[model samples]
Target: MTTIPMYDPLSPEMISDPYPAYARMLEERPIHWHPVMRAWVVVRHADCVRVLREHATFARDPGRTGEEIPDFRQNVQMMDPPEQTPLRQLLVGAMRSQDKDQLFQEAVAFLRGRLTAQEPGEPFDWMATLAAPFALHMSAALLGVPEPDDEAYAEISHGIALRMDAGLAPENIPQGDAARKRLNELGESWFPRPEGDDGLIANLIRRADKEFAGSHYIRNSAAMMFNASYGTIFAMVGNAAHLLATVPGLLPELSVPSHVATGVDELIRYDGPAQGTSRTAVTETEIQGTRIAAGDSVVTLLAAANRDPLVFKDPQDIKLDRRPNPHLGFGSGPHACFGSEFGKLSITAMIHALRDEGLRPCLAAEPTRRTTATVRSLDVLPVRLSR
Candidate 1:
């Protein structure tokens, strides 16, 4: 019987490239218990799916472990069914009733115009100049924030991302708390107590009663929106570009809009932005004959599960037209991502715009990955754009 490696969630190497370590963990023991973190890792597809979908047994509340992952407070992502349902409904309804389709088209046009304005041969940090800014701007627009220039928007969004990516560390806690306060102040100033449902922010305020609605709720919701919009969406763009650039004959295939959307989905499945999510066991349970005790943390490795051969054939290979690609790239069950559609649209638009400009990514330097235990993303994807 091989002993499971004591995986340190905060290790730089683990954040840089976690797949190798994940594979080893899965191979050694699918349900390995982490002594240091006091967490149980679920690396296989079936196990991850079960844990995420079985909310009754596994809870999303980090506070259950007596340790709250920093900045997760009051966010819909951490809430259970009764609380989560209404919040999700309000958000989804607002998105649907609003002119989001038009907004998305406008965002795409803006990106294309900007890309066209750039010098043909000029090399730029695509992630910084294009991917990150575009995501931040689109998100701000979606949430009805003031239309700041892409650079300014990116700066604020980057700050928020830094705070979020820090997770629940003591040193980073102060920064995250400060950012949250700043974000709340900004949201209040920008969208000050509208009389009617004017925008996303206004809608959130209206939805909240005197009891449930307040400055804190509004601010935390905005922060969550910004994090989802900027962090995950930015990483999606980088991952898509990186994957397309490496795959033989894939860039050319993304010339069409439909193909662009399909390719984006494949990239998400192949190298999702969020590698895994942790859930705490609410009660004693047995998974695949492995006994799990209450208060145990289970980390579901989504990246590993996406590549599980049991669920996907040739899972490592990118298939642009992969049909029935039931991947948990957006997660599963009640806690599934609420902004999946927006994310897909953002990625597709960016890829299509890049393809239209005949821009191909030439890797200038190896990607510098963001340091986080739960998410897999690149900090700086240095690439030279070429025709």
Candidate 2:
């Protein structure tokens, strides 16, 4: 057996750039048992794709096959095929209802407002000022959070994120607990909205059967909305902006819609915000002859899979024009990021906004990153708007 290399996804060095290590792992032990994370980290693109698509053997929540987790069952992402199929179909219908052109226009309108108001020579944090608000507004609309209650929406989102992502510190768990309570209460109000309503909250209400007649599904589903949709978008757009700003001569390509779309895909493919996710083996399984016993956890390193040399040509290089790009940035299979369309549109709008007037780093404060293991996010990014 080849000696599997050790790489801690939580370490600060990994936070800066986990790709080089991931590359090594993919080449040496694509199915290496990572001691630090205590799971077999699948680094190859083919293997990750299979793990995601093969929902039968690899269950999202191992508890589902054994003991039931009430909250986990409600989360569509944490569900398996036979159970999640119907619910996911319903969500697909709702997602299709959204007008992509309208979304693009809305994104442009919102981002242009922020960019126009920026101080020419000074640095401004893009995440708080633009990315957060843009994502918050869009998520609010999707979750059916009514206008004029920004505080409630914010609190609910923060609490949901803390609970789902384990972002809350031990001492801060109380705040998250309180926030979840608030979200449950808010669900009550949202669940009673008219049947004709289009927000995700209302949509979930309409789909609820006797078993799910209330906000039980709504509250948990909202977490999925935040994580896969709004939160992912917020992180990716911000990260993409920071990366794009550093690239020279790409501003012109942003003006073209085809290029913008492909650019967003490549940007996400190269350095997407999603760090990695884990799944549990339902029964015994083997990959490349490596045995994975039932109940063992397997972590899929998405960023690593996105850069597998076997799948991508010149894997290290970021080519916006890269075609046949089947990167697992949005993931794959049943639990793939369904909200990817909206995210792509949002990124395209960002590109166009920057194209109007080029952007440069402010040098006022260096960009900083959060110390998170499951996701990569920026703490602050300062950029100067240039015309």
- Which segments of candidate 1 are over 4 A away from where they belong? 3-13, 63-72, 147-170, 190-197, 205-215, 256-258
Q: On residues 1-387, what C-alpha lDDT tens digit does candidate 1 reach at each position? A: 776457766678787666677667666667777665566778789999999989888999666556654543566776777667776676666665556677768777867886777677666676877777777778777787765456655555555555543434446656656655665555556545556546776776676666555545546666677667777878888877777656777787766656666667778988888888878898999887889998877878788888877788887788887877888899998888878888888877776677666777777667777766555667787777678
Error of 2 at 197 (Å): 3.6
Q: What TM-score would each prediction reach against the true structure? A: 0.87, 0.88
Model 2 C-alpha RMSD vs. true structure (Å) is 3.2
lDDT of 2 at 127: 77
State each model's CA lDDT, in order. 0.72, 0.72
- Pull out the clashing pairs in model 1: none
Error of 1 at 357 (Å): 2.2
